[model samples]
Target chain A: MRTASPAPSRWALRVVGLGYLTLLLLAPLVAIFYKTFEHGLAPPIEAITSTNGLHALKLSLLMVVIAVPLNTIFGIGCALLLVRHKWKGNALIDSVINLPFAMSPVVIGLALFLLYGAKGWLGPDLAEAGVEILFSVPGMVLASIFVSIPFVVRETVPVLQEIGTEQEQAASTLGANAWQTFWRVTLPSIRWGVAYGVVLTTARVLGEFGAVSIVSGSRSGETETLPLYVKKAFDNFEFPAAYGASVLLALLALTTLLAMNVLKRKEDA
Target chain B: MGISVEGAVKSFGDFQALDDVSVEVPDGSLTALLGPSGSGKSTLLRAIAGLETLDAGRVTIDGEDVSTKPTQKREVGFVFQHYAAFKHMTVFENVGFGLKIRKWDKAKIADRVHELLNLVQLPGLADRYPSQLSGGQRQRMALARALAVQPQVLLLDEPFGALDARVRKDLRAWLRNLHEEMNVTTIFVTHDQEEAMDVAGQLVVMNQGRVEQSGSAEDLYEHPANEFVMSFVGEVNRLGEDFVRPHDIEVVLEADDRTEEGVVKRIVALGFEIRVEFVLGDGTDVWVQLTRNELQRLELREGQIAFLRPVQAKSFNGSTPSDPPGASTPQGSDDGGDAEVSAAV
Candidate 1:
C-alpha cells in the first residue's frame, strides 16, 4: 500500500529519515562492532594481522590504487567530451558512460570474464601473449575499473555543463591555446567536481566486490580482496575476522562519505 | 587593424541566426554592431573573433584572411557579454593569462598586469577575485584582461549590458576614453542606439539577420538607409506614408504651398525643447519637436490652428506607399536595392 502523507510534519519527515537510516544502516554497523568485540579484541586483531587477512586488505588497497587514477582520467575526459562538443553519437556515448550504474556489477564482472576468461573471447590470444587475465589481478582490476566508471563522470558532467563554455572561449580569444586553456581555465573551473568525482571513484573502487569476486575466481591469498575475504570468513565460520573486516570496510566507507560531504560543502561554498 | 565579415551566414536548425551579413571596421576604429535580440549581432562579433565557425564566408582581420585560424591564432581580444571572469583566478592571474600563454617572463607578466589594472582604473585589486568586484569593476577587469596582450583587434559583446543605468553610462564614457587611448580596431555588439552612437565611431544597424545600414551617427540620423535604420536610430514621426524626424517638422501660422493644415492637440514644454502634437483633418496624430526659442518665435499654443511643413521627411521602400505594414520583410529584399520608404504626399 502506498500511504501518501501529503502534508507530513517536518519532525515526522525527520523521524522517518533518521529511523530508516538507523534501522537499516546504524543497527547493522553497531551489531558488527559488538560481534567483533564479543570474544574480546585479541581475536579480531589476530585475524586481521593474519597473512591471508593482511593480503586481502592489501589487495583491496591495490585495486583502489590502480583503478582510481584510470577512472579519474577517463571520467574527466568523458565529462569534457559530453559537455563541450557535439557529435553524431554524443548522446549515445553520454548514456554509455553511465552504463555501469544501470547494469549490475556482477554482470559487469561476468562480461569481463566472458571477454578475458581462460576459455573465453580474447583469453587464448592473451594467454599466448603470456598474460593472465581472468582469475587474476588484472581481471579483478578490470572489474574495479568497470564498477567505478560512472562516479567521476557523473559528478563532473553537470558541473562542466553549469560552468558553460564562455570562460573557455574567453581564454582562447585571449591567446591561450587549447592545451593551455584546459590546464588554466577549464581544469581549475571544474576542479571541485573532479575532486568529488575522484573521491567517489576511490570509494567505488575500494568497495567493488561482486564484479571483482566473479572475475578473481575467489582465490584465497592472491586475489582475495577485503570484501570477498570478509564473505569467505563468514562462510567458513570465522565470525571474528568477518565482522572485524566488515567493521573496517564500514569505517572506510564512512571516511569516503565524510570526504564526499566535505567536498560537497566546498563546492557549494 | 581593420576587420571585415564577407557574406557571413550561420544557422541553427530551422532558424537562420545570420543571413549573408557583412560589415567593415576600419583600422583603429570603434564600431558597434547594433541589432535587436536574435538578430545575429553577437554571432557576427563571434565570427570576427573566430569563436564561431562560419558555415560559409570568410572573416578577414586587417589584410590577411583568417577564416580558418583558431581563436588563439587570430590575435584578437574578445570579451564575453556576461564578463566570463575566471572565478578561480585572481585579477592579476586573469589579466596575465594571455601573456603567460605567450610565455612571458614572470616579472614582466606581473608588470603588464599591474599596468593594465591601473589602466582599467582597478588598482589594488590584483589579488582580489572577480566575485569581490562590483558589476562595473568586473566589466573593466574583463576589458583590461582582453587588452593585456596587445591584441590586433578587440571585440566586446555588450560589455556594460549587465550594469545598472548609471554604471552603464559611466562605463560607456570610460570605454570611449579607453578606446581613444589604446586605438585598437575594436568592434562591440550593442542593441542600444544611444550606446552605439555614444561609444562607437560607426554603427551597423541589423534587422532579421541582415545589415540594414552601416554609417556614422549623423549619417544614420540625418539619412537612415531604410525604415529599419530610420526607426532604429532615433525617434521619427510617421505622417501618412512619410517617416519624418521630429526636428525636421516646422510649425508656421500662415498656410504655405508645402504645408498641411492641422489643429494643435497639445504642446509639452520640456526644459530645453518643446514637443507639439497635432490632429490633421483626417484625425491622424503628427508630432513635431522644436526648440524653446523656436516655439517662442512661432508663438505656438494648444488648441490653435497651424500649418506644418515637412522640411526633410523620408519615405523608405521598406514600407509600401499605399499600405505601410505590407512591407514587413522590406530589408529582406534590400541588397537588391529596393530602396528605403521615404518622402511621400
Candidate 2:
C-alpha cells in the first residue's frame, strides 16, 4: 500500500521567513537610529544649525528641484523616441541612454573634468565665455544629472513598450490629432510609470556622492552639498558633527522612501 | 457611407497579411470580415481603419479617397478586441473623450455622452469606472465611447471574442439591432462563423491574407466559392460520391413478403428530419432522411438498409465527385469515381 506525503507546516515556514527578514533588514535600521540618538538629540540639533551644514542642505535641496523635473522631461522624450521611431544607429542610441547606469560616477566626473576643466577639451572656449563649470555650482548639478540619467529612462521605457501602440491607433481613428492622441491616450496610460521614474531619479540624485564631490570643489558655502559636508566633518575629526549630519541625511532618505510608498499605494488604488 | 477597398495588399516583413483583398461594404449595411486566426480578416479591418498602411491599393469611403489620409481625418470609430476602455476614466468621461479632444463645448460633450450611454443601455452606469463594470457592461461602454463621436464608419475587431457564449449570443443580437437602428456603415471582424452569418447583412470570407469569397450568409452557405469557405461557414459532411442535404433524402426499407424487412441503423434527430443511415442489399451503405412523424410511425433500429432517392438535385460549390451523389443520381450507384465525373452536371 502507498502512503501520502505530509505537507509542510505553514507556521514553521512563516516563522523562519519572518525571522530572517527581520534580522537582515529591520535590525540594521534600528541600530542606526539607536546609535544616533544614544547620546542625545542636542548633538544632531547643533550640527543641523552650523552655517556650512545648513548651506549644504539648501544647495542639495535646490539641486533636486532642478534635476528631477528636467530629467523627467528628458527621460520621457528619450523613451518616446526610442520606442516609437526607427532611425539609423537607434540601437546605439538606446545603449548610450543606459551607459550612465553601468559606468562609475568617478569616471563620469573625470570625463566632465576633461570637457570643462582647464587645459582640456572645450576648456579654452568655456574660459573665453567666462563660464565657470568645474569647481562651481553648475558643475555639481551637471555631475548629479549624469549619475541619475538612467533611473527615469529605465523605469519608463519598459512601461511604454508593454502598453504598445494600439491605444494611440484607436484614438486617432476617433478623430484625435497626434497631440490629442498623445495627451488623451498615451500620457495618461504611462503616468504611473513616469511617477515611478521621477521617484527613483530623485532618490538617486539625493544619495549621489562621488561625482558631485569631484566637481563641487567642497567650497564651504558655495558648491558643497550635504554629503560632502558630512565627509568634511569626518575628515576634520569632528565625530559628533559627522554623525549628526549622517542622521539628517538618513531622515531625508527615509522621508523619500515614505513618499514613494505612498505614491505606489495610490498607483495600486 | 459605402466603403470600397480594391486590390489592397499589406505585408509585414515576409508574412503577407493582406494580399490582393477587395471588398465593397454597402452604405448602411453591416458587413462581417469572417476568417480563422492568421486569415488576415483583422488586417483588412485595420487597413480600412487606416491603422495599417497598405503596399498597394485604394480605399474609397463615400466616393472619397481615404487611402492617403491619416486615421484622424478618416472619421472612423474603432472598438478593439480588448475593449480598450480608458481604465482611469468614468464611463461618461470615456465616452466623451473624443469630444473633449476635439475641444467641443462642455455642455455638448456631456449631452452627447449621456445620449450614447442611453443608447447602449447603461444610463445610470456613466459614473462607474471601467474596472467597476462587468465584462459585458464594459463592452457596452466601449461601444458607446466609439459611437459618441457620430463617426461615418464604425469598425470592431472581434468585439465579442472575449465574452462567454451566452453573452456572445446576446451581444450578437444586440449588435445586429443596434446596427440597424444606427444605420451606419459598420464592419466587424469575427472568427465565429455563426456570429458572422447571424449578424452581418453581407459577408466577406478571407483566408491566408487573400479573399476567398464575398456574398450574403445564405449564398455562402449554399454555394461556397471554395473548399475552405464551405468547411468554414457551417458543419458539412463530405462523402465519396457527392454531398446531399439530409432533408432531400427518401428512405425505403426493403421488406420481405407483406412489409419492409430492414432494421434501422442509426436514427439522428435533425430538428426537422430524422436521418437514417443503413446498409443496402448490395452491401452498400446509404443514408436517408425522414420526417419525425414518419420515424415515429415506423420504429427504426440498427442493421437496416435504406433505399434512398432524391427529393431534389442541386450541385453545391466545393462539392467534389467523392461525395456519394446528391439526392438525384441520374447515373446509378454513387460509388467513388462516378461522382466526380458527373460533378460538373
Candidate 3:
C-alpha cells in the first residue's frame, strides 16, 4: 500500500475512498447517534430501561449466552472432522455446513417452525410431552444457534489445515498423548482463528432478526428480543425506544468489529 | 539400544512407499537412510518411529518389538524436516514438553531443558519463542527438544534439508559431534550422498521402496550391490552399457589393444579433479576423471583422439535402471575384471 506514486493522485484516491465510505457508512451511523440523542438522552434512557426494553435486552443476551458456547464446541469439532479426518461423505458435509450462510434467515426460521411446530414432524409427540420448542425460549435459542454455527467452523478449518499435523506428529513422538497434543499444540496454534469466529458468532447472535422473529412468536415481555422490540417500537411510533435499541445494537456490532480486527492482526502476525 | 525393521511393507494407493524392507543398525551407531526423492527413506524412518504404520512388519528398539505400540509409547524422538518447533511455546517450554507430559518436577525440568539447550549450543535463548529464532536456531532447538527425552532411538527425516548449504554442512558436523558425545542410536534420512558419507557410520541406500544396499560408506562406494547403488552413491558415466565411475577410467596417448579410442569432447578443471568428457567411437559420451598431475602427464586436448583404459572400474553385467532385485549379476569387487568395452555399439 506504500506505493511510490505521485502525491496528488494518491491524495485524490484516499479522499475519494474516504468520501465514499463516509457517505455510505459513517453518515448513517452519525444520523443514528444524532437522532438517538436528539431531545437530550433522558427520553431514550427511560425508553430503554422500561420493562419491555429490559426484558428484550435480557432475552437477546440469554440467547447469545446459550448459543455461542454450544456453537463454539460444535464448530471446533466440525472443523477438525472436516480437515483432519477422512470419511465417505466429507465433501457433502462440508457443503452442508454452509447452508446457513446461503439461505435467508427467514427461510431457516420457517424450516424450524415446520419441523417443530404442532402439525409438523416430531411436533405431536413434543406436544404430548409438553416439550415446547416452537414459541418458546428454546425455539429462539435454536434459531440463533443455527444461524451462527458456520462462523467458527469456517474460520477454523483453513487455519487447522495450514498448520498441518507435523507438530502433532512431533508431539506424539515426544511422548505426548492425543489429548495433550491437542490441548497444548493444536489448540494454542488455532486460538486466534477460533477467536475471530467467536466474534462473528457473537455478532450474529446479537443482531439476528428474521429467524428468531418467526419462532419467538413476538411475545411482549417473554420471547421478544432486541431487534424485535426495535421494530415493534418503530411500528408503534415510539421513536425514542426504537432509536435507543438500534443504537445499542450498533454499539454491540462495533465492539465485535473491533474484536475481529484485533484477532485478524494476531492471526496474520 | 539400536533399532531394526523386519519385513516392513507399506503402500499409499498402489505406490509402494516401503516394500518389505528390513534394516539393522548396530547399537549406539549413527546410520543414514539415504536415497533420491520418493525413494522411501523418510517413510521407513517414520515407520521406525511409529509415526507411520507398516502393513506387514515390526519395529524393534532395544530388542523389544514396538510396531503395534503408539508413537508415544515407542519412546523414539523424531525431528522433522521443517523443524516443527512449537511456535506457541518458548524454547525452554518446547524442550521441556516431554518432561512435562511425564509430570516432571518444575526445577528438574528446568535443569534438563537447560542442559539440552547447552548441548545444542542454543544457550541463553530459552525465553524466546520459535518465531524469534533463525532457521538454524530453530532446527537446533528441535534437536535439543528431541534429544531431551533421551529415548532409546532417534529418527530424523532430512533434518538439514531445509537449510542452505553452509548451514547444512555446519549442522551435519555439529550433529555428528553431538552423536559421538551422546552415543545415542540415531537414524537420519537424507538424499545427499555426501552428507551421508560425512557423518553416518553406516549408509543404507534405498530406491523405489526397497533398500538397495546397506553398509559402511566406504563399503558402499567401493562395493556397490547393483547399478543403482554404483550410480547413485557417486557420479558415474555410462561407458557403453555398463556404469563407470569417472575416476576409474584412465586417459592414455598410445593406441593399445587395452585402450578404446575416443575424441576428447570437453575438459573441465573441477576444483579438486579434472573432468574430461570423451565422445567414444560409438558416439556415446563418457567422462574420465584425472588429477592435474595426471592431465599434465597425458597432455590431452579437446577434439583430439585419446585412447582410454579402464582401471579398477567397478562394472555391472546389466546396468539397466529399474531392474528388479536379483535380476542383475554383480560384477563389481569380484574377479577384478577390467572395464574394457571394445566399442561394442
Q: What docking grade does candidate 1 earn?
A: medium
Across A1-269, the per-residue lDDT of candidate 3 in tens digits comes to 86587999989999999999999999999999999999998988998899999999999999889999999999999999998998978899899999999999999999999999999998889989989999999999999999999999999999999999999999999999999999999999999999999999999999999999999999979999999999999999999999999999899899899989988998888
Report the lDDT of model 2 for residue A246: 78
Model 3 clashing residue pairs (backbone): none
In terms of lDDT, which candidate is strongest?
Answer: 3
Candidate 1 Cα lDDT to native: 0.87
Stretches > 4 Å off in candidate 1: A1-8, B247-311, B318-345
Q: How well is each residue in B162-202 modelled by candidate 2, as lDDT tens digits?
A: 99999899999999999989999999999999999999999
lDDT score, candidate 3, position B296: 89
Find the candidate with the highest TM-score and give its number. Answer: 3
DockQ of each: 0.69, 0.63, 0.88
Query: Candidates' lDDT values, in order?
Result: 0.87, 0.81, 0.89
The Cα error of candidate 3 at residue B200, in Å, is 0.8
Cα-based TM-score, every candidate: 0.88, 0.86, 0.93
Ranking by lDDT: 3, 1, 2
Query: What is the C-alpha lDDT profile of model 1 across A7-49, one tens digit per residue?
Result: 6676799899999999998898898889889988899888888
